[model samples]
Target: MSNAPSSPTGPVNRLAETTSPYLRQHAHNPVDWWPWCEEALALARETDRPILLSIGYSACHWCHVMAHESFEDPGTAELMNRLFVNIKVDREERPDLDKIYQTAHQLLAQRPGGWPLTVFLMPDDQKPFFAGTYFPREPRHGLPAFKQLMQGVERAYREQKTAIESQNESLMAALAELEPHASDALPERSAIDAALQQLDTSFDPEHGGFGDAPKFPHPTNLDLLLRHATDAPQTGAPDRSALAKAVWTLERMVRGGLTDQLGGGFYRYSVDALWMIPHFEKMLYDNGPLLALCCDAFAVTEDPVFRDAAVMTADWVLREMQSPEGGYWSSLDADSEGEEGKFYVWDREEIRALLAPAEYAPFAAVYRLDRPANCEGRWHLHGYRTPEAVAVDLGLEPARVQALLAAARATLYVARERRVRPGRDEKVLTAWNALMIKGLARAARTFDRPDYLESAEQALAFIRGTLWREGRLLATYKDGTAHLNAYLDDYANLLDALLELLQTRWSRADLDFALALAEVLLDQFEDPIGGGFWFTGRDHETLIHRTKPLGDEAIPSGNGVAALALERLGHLVGEPRYLAAAERTLKLAAESIRRMPYAHATLLFALDEWLDPPETLVIRAGDERLDAWRREAQRGYRPRRFVLGIPADESHLPGTLAAMAPGERPRIYRCSGTRCEPPTESLADVVKPTS
Candidate 1:
């Protein structure tokens, strides 16, 4: 298959008009790329040629490599353009296509799937019969050259038409088997215990994460652990061991290279088991849940580490990622100037020259300057020793040592600003932006940072002003173009974010926004005949298949978030229909919940709430201070506790809490499903749980 290929060249393509930054990145490729649309598919069917579907996002490193190698090479591009209808898709913009093809890829390759996914689909129904990731421009590393592979695939399709159709028929059957489990019973609360037991099998006790090398921080699983840890003492739950795991993982991640110590964000994941080497992409989606997790960890453990991490990550979002208007951008790429980690790594001599001798001593010892470089012969600044250890080694006060390192880190950060930076995908995605707003709102309330809340409000206002048009939501916005129909995740996640935002500080407009989104979720996305919601809206363009997403992958499952938001909004608005929808969705996934608890962590959270409905605490403003009482009430990790405060001058009461009207004095009312205990003025009594 090794053959001498023609030189690489460039030509503009139809992708120039695409809204996605990912697609635009390939506008000048030699491959004659066509945006994923009817025209491209129509041509393939008319010519009886196969479709080459290349799917990836903007921040993907290997996606860029493949484009440069095969898509840019004249010979490979010529072969691709001649043999198939070349379609380029931004996975972020078309997750429905990505999800369907990714499953097919796994089935065909019998391996896990990832970015730069290359799939060859039948022209008739867009059903994929062959799949792979990142083909070399020429033969290398035991993989066939791109041109050779294309030739082989084309020849096989032409010569073995009968066998190919037979195989696709079997493949179609395999795809159908991936559907959700059908069950007659709701998942029992005992499944939470089962999940924790299964999670323990992969839990790395010493390192504080799941499994081995190429570790990903599964925020969903960590969230389940945090909630379980918080309720263990009160409910006698067996997942008390979750606390140690959560704390250990958070601490290790913060100390390792996975976190951008100089810049104030986290890389996507670690390339090694110890979290020492990271993939270097900074994603807004990953940071959002991670920040929320850090805040919850701080609340549960009172660990200064978690608090510091939350502050740093939030600061990074505001500093580097916020758009010119107010929305948060999607991601920052892992590479700069054709080299991965170039923007982040530091030279030892450069560090020494940038810092004072006194500053360098402690910083060097703490950050492992004495050890071999981890990335391309340059240090990535992962601290090897704790501040206390450094203080002891330096024979100095811990506080003094901390001051020195902080000063040194500041200097290093300034010097790094002079380097060429990784590309930023400035597209503001509705679902991703909502995650950040929710994270910021949580941080604002938990850490008492009004600035954080202000940031959230700014982003929320931007979304409302620009993305919402004519009573419908748009998914991605970049350079004043917002076209794609918003999906279930956009509405579901935004509803969840708004609910969290409302808790921090009540605003009727935001509340109305939440209500409107819920209406859309039920109307446009929900399965009226079955249960759960589809990934695309009813108004969305008809595709080969409409998917009802149920598990967490890359982000929280749309179905899980929809169920969660419905439950919360239902109770807060006194809407029975919303609650019923939530219950129906949960019932649909009951069997899957019992079997794979960790994979379906977010759904399990919703399931947990269903098992035990939460109590609503409405505090009426009087002349008394709210510090001690509020602290005691929120000290434990009570995921089921709902608290709201209203001033005495307030008048409008929503249908959800009409029972707790404002009064002359500051008082607290605890209500559960229309029943309320007498109002209490005493803080100590209010702090006591049902126990």
Candidate 2:
């Protein structure tokens, strides 16, 4: 009867001493677990036991499943305790550790899987030899049981340790070769053309998204495609029809169930290719990029659908996700009431009961709820009538029908809120909040909504005051305390947010802070030898390998954001070093960029910088008319454009850029390099090319 919850069948260990919710959840497990630290590694080295590393986030469904089925089971845990130095890591707090190990798993599995990542490593050096995801308690689903797998791995480590170590060494060597490189042989322009053509062919013209089942937002890719559609090429012939189709597809996404009709934000992704029947989880990162994309789409088409979707997403973040202190929450779980889509799915009878008899039929018809349920014996609501369809159904004008739907949807949202909502993971991640802040700030300026700007400012203040210490940012904050060293994403995204805020509000402090953080990012995260940025800061816990992640994931790659940050810093601070760093990173990642341009959206933006440098628009005065012109310019689909708003009364610009003359009339100066265009007073003239 040890206090460690040993079932008389398993060994006892020190993970029982910690209070990290993730660790505490495993404290009573029969497995002897060790919290990651120098002590754990030393124990592994001393015992000659291969370290069994289990990494996952608290809200991950599969993580919970593994804990229940294996970690908590006395028999399975006993075998694990006897064989390995079990270590648990919360990937949310230590994304650096997760990145390296997850990359190793990807190499081993040859395909990606998520949650409860189990990696087995050598004792002394912590070099991973084997990696896989969750395993069941007993053999099921054609997969080996946890006990059998652990015994096999333990036997291999004990009997064939040398061979296992040699294999791991080879794996690491192969992983090192995965880095992207700039090659003279790469057909860069042609690759981009091919990617665009592939997109055109792959595009679901009948619907709005790309490819087949399990459609993702891929907002970055869509944004890039939209740019190609709108911006007339400097050399090649313009494809106006392709641009129109792109715009049409984007509009469809806005109107489809991919967008939350009753709620204001998007679900993680659509399970189907038609942008209907979304997976129930809602991630902060997905919403951020989607919000920005929606804002841009609204700017191009001035389509009300795009505008409403953007506003709704911003509103959702502000209402549901925003922390009391101002930063946004991480995500909403996919499951509630013991089922994945329970909170979101509805029964036909339940819908009928909730609405008046007459109202129910019309509402059901409007939402396409009269059809057989999409989910097994349940209706997963989707695909509300289009404007034309709604017009026909309501026997009214299209505009009037749209207005009515909007008003009715607001009422339904309130009713939906009354139901049991999915649990929110309220940990405020600095990188994600930074992305959302930038998205909201950009949306605010584009939509002329001061509230969105205010939300962004408040979140920035919270991050600066609460999550920042001694000029360095903390990665996560919860319950009034910040923990974990800030990653490169935090610095890069925060810098991007500051730049966006500067454009929105012309805040000098924001500009100065952004410049300083950009410098810190270069100094701390930059790989001077490798020519890219590492995810972990220089002072954070060192791993067996430092990975420079450039591949796109749920969020844009840190390297992509870092490149964008460096380019913006260069433009803002008038320093070639920042630009040079960005160029080097892009060059280093050129091979991957050329091969998978769709995956490297932010990098494409960086490439656009080299191909056609961002136009610096300096406005010396702030008149409402001038603000409108500046906002319009920002709203337009100009990927290679930067705006610096300097009030005429300010003594100097923060960067090396020169200040404009003080004058009564507001002026716009468009500069590319050392040369500046003649100052123009006409708003129409400034916005003419934007249309």
Candidate 3:
């Protein structure tokens, strides 16, 4: 599945020289595609041609559809090549570019942007003046034909050049105002309560998610609710009902079509409000946060449903998403063969023929295979009944119902494997891998799963070896090449991941790596006086607008993660430099955090930690009791807590834990700021909250 040219005579573009899997995907396209690099930008400026920037990821269905419809067509390619300096970018590989352009598209068109982003940018500054998404080959569905759009754009540039330039100027001004410097006023209890109140209003009580149809897994927002449910209960907060929202959303997502009922993993999002009939693509980013949430949700509610989802998603990653090199792959495409949902959906007759009479009835009854086809003429399986309900309906024990359902799933999953599988985008992104590593480590720590911890450690080892070069990080790795300047999220996420991984399994190397990441973050990404970190490193290419993102989108906020990671590292290592940076960033983002607390979710969480920080417990022991106590200490989701075990044999425990020298007995010390409490042999004593 390569498009690279073997001979000089072959028709290929500059993408053949790229490392991005998405860029290489278009190497054989009829369009003369140029990777988003200095050379392409230079060519556009030198030729006085407007830039046709098309941004998308490889696994995006609409991206592939547009590529097939227009980029691969010789006639359409001619129009593109002749009139514009066509540049292609994989959004995953270059999110800084994507972020700037997506926002620019929003400003110019006054609508939200999506993948297969089509924008006409001025060659002088690469500022978008006109923008759209997925124009058809022929004019249809209120979209201009690809050729027609290009010709019109060319005409606008030639005849209406002044108007386009004016629009570009206005767009740039709008972008500048996107992040106005607000007062360094921190978000308080009222702001946090308001965010919860907002969620309550937007929450879909019947369906389990926020907002209307085409629902996404807003993992950060859900996590915020989880935090509120746990922390604000004692505060007389406006929304003490948050726990219900978090638990209900997690449970329903697992039971609905959004989750892969047989295979274990989640789809990208649901098209319908009920979370039935998802878009079908599975992303590592979505699963990782969801996995961590499910783990905490189980602990918070004492519900097996959350545990089931957490286990299923983890198993799916270990079984399907993880590469042999220990790095997690990017995504699985929504469509298989030529149709969407073709791989996972099943026909009733096919299921009935494959299963035994006893199995078929329970399977159909449990997974809603008995209901009318919800996806075209095929059934995309979702849990139609709870285990208790299935048990009652089938006249069997609850345990027996679960056993039968498990067997049925195994049968179905094996058969599904024989079908045409969705394509896997094997490009391993550093930020996404870091998120998964964190999720895996958190789950392992919560559940005391050695295998999950081991897997996370292996992935971290791979990341350190492959992505970390010199003292800095690389954004992505694929086909034995690690290129592109790592963004703030890469350093921030990996730092957070190393911190999490340290709890599961301590290592001097990982600690050293975390320190280096922290240093690089401060040195390269931080906006000193202004406070938050920039999306790109200081040495990276200058874009139209450098973003210091505070709000969560498809991913958690980078600046928020930076503050959280630095604060934790600062406390754990006794470093003032890290602590100062975290405080400054929080102060910079404070007002935004106050106004839109839900949008600034991670920031608010960081603020909560900063104002009244979590205890950093360093357990000095190696015996079974120590391990049990470590698990016991982390029984619930305490977002502020960072519990680490320093086995008696462990060497190079950070200087903060120097007092905890290995002795005959295992002792736990609760360290907060620069103070350490008396060593405790009892788990209950160590777990107690400090007055």
Candidate 4:
């Protein structure tokens, strides 16, 4: 699967010179595609033609469908080239444009928007007047044909210019209205309770997810749930009831088709509520958060299932996603061999011949192979029954059944490897790699896996070495080029990841990297007047609109993560400026958080820390108990706690960490908010609340 369009004989367009794999995927399209650059925008204005902008990522299935059905067709491509300046953008590479246009599409269509997003913009202002997604080559499914739609759009642009201009005015106003307005105070704890209540209302008791069919992993929501469950009563035990919903959901996901049974990563999402059929694309962003969530879930419940899921996911990333250059790749495409799920689905005879009767019987019984085909008339593996249940049916021991299934899976995986693999988008994205680094570091600390920590450090080193330059960061890198001004997510996420990595293994260089990112975030991305962070940097290219978003989407909110990271770093280094910035961000989003707290899970996380600042534990020890002390302090899940253990001989520490010099014996300094308890050797006293 080259991911090239069907029209392969045409001369390459401007996309041929770009680094984005998504844009390059359309290089051979008959549609004279132009990369979204100043040159393309200028050409549209010079010709006085509308700009047809299509935004999507490499792994999106419908993006491929639209490209194949319309962009590849000669007649359709000719119309697109003649009528408008066809500009293509990879959403991953240029999320600022995608965010603005997607919001416009939602407002225009009165529904949610998705890729491949189609918009017609006035070239002079670049304001979209018409928008849609995935129109067919010929009229079907209530959508007008792409050719007819373009002609109509062109006629409107020429004849009804005034009406379009009027609509654009209203659209711009609506987009501005969507930005959060600053409030005087921080959000109250009632908002957190309300969010949990809301989750409970929408939670599917039968299926263990939030909503009906087409369930996403929603890692942020799960993380909030897990933290809520474990934030105990200082001395008493935690409320175990809150853990049930998140644990139930996580267990079902691990056993479902959403997880790769033979492989070791999760697909994009499940197409059904039962989690039995997935969309079948693996993304680094999704897995990173999910990996950390699994580790936390294991810590809270001591469940082996979560630990296993974390191990498998980490192994998959190490084996498949990590590049030789040390940065993690963005995503794996959903389609292979020109068809969806062609690489993962299996026929009945293929499985029967691969395994012995004992292995085949247990595998078939547990993985729904004995039942009718579940996906595209072939089996996509899902845990139809537990091994214990399958063992009873097969008249075998549970341990023996597990051994047989493991052997069967190994054989099947080897056979599957011989097939053509899906196309991998090899571009290294800073925001996404930071997310994976955070997950890997958390997993390493929780599971005591040095290898995981090393992998995380390598990715961080790649970013520091390649992306970070001259007190700033680059958004993405591929081949030998790293360009595009870094966005808020890049700076905020990497800073947060650096904090996590420091907890695993403190590095002076990493600490310096974290401090630099924090400074860049406050200097370049923060909206001083408005009191929150903008999605784009100050030096970013001018666009139709500049956005400051507070809600969580596919990933955590950048503003939310920024506030959290800045606040944590402030406590660590005694920087009141960083602390003040975080406080202002919370106040800025106060009203929005109250109105829709569920959508602002990341912000709620920051708010939780704000309402009651985290307990900071500084350990200065010379003995081997340093590792043991750190681990024991973090034994149970405490979301409002930070622990850092420095060696006895380490020197030149910053802020409060520097003041706490090593004593004759192991000593701990506990700080809550502005107050600090005297140095104590007892771990129990440090773990308890200071009165």
Give the best candidate by lDDT: 4
Ordered from best to worst TM-score, the candidate numbers read 4, 3, 1, 2
- Candidate 3 TM-score, C-alpha based: 0.95
**CA deviation > 4 Å runs, candidate 2:** 1-30, 182-187, 235-238, 241-245, 248-252, 622-629, 678-685
Once superposed on the true structure, which residue ranges of model 4 sit more than 4 Å away at CA?
A: 7-10, 232-237, 688-691
Superior by lDDT: candidate 2 or candidate 4: 4
Candidate 2 residues 24-100, lDDT tens each?
A: 55776777888888988999999888899999765566776788788878788778878999999877777888888
Q: Give all candidate RMSDs, comma-separated.
A: 3.5, 3.8, 2.6, 1.9
Candidate 1's C-alpha runs over 4 A off are 1-11, 233-240, 622-637, 649-652, 673-675, 681-683, 689-691
- Residue-by-residue lDDT tens digits, candidate 3, 486-534: 9988999899999988887667788888888999999999888888889
Per-candidate local distance difference test: 0.84, 0.76, 0.84, 0.89
- Over the stretch 1-691, how does candidate 1's per-residue lDDT look in tens digits? 0011113234578987887888888877777889988888899999999999999988898898887887767787788889999999988888878988988889899999999999998898888878999888779999898888899999988898889889888887887767674455678888887887777889998777899999998899988887887675337664557888878888999988899998888899999898888999999999999999899888877878789889999999999999879999989998887888898998999999999999999999999899999887999988788889999989999999989988998999999899888888888999999999999999998988999999999999999999999888999898888878888889999999998887777577888889999999999988755688888988888776677778898789999999988887787768888888888888888877866878888888888777776777767774445434554566545567777665565667667566666565578888664456888876565567633
Measured by C-alpha RMSD in angstroms, how accurate is candidate 4? 1.9
Candidates sorted on lDDT, descending? 4, 3, 1, 2
lDDT (Cα) of model 3: 0.84
Q: Over all chains combined, what TM-score does candidate 4 have?
A: 0.97
Ten-residue region with minimum lDDT total, candidate 1: 1-10
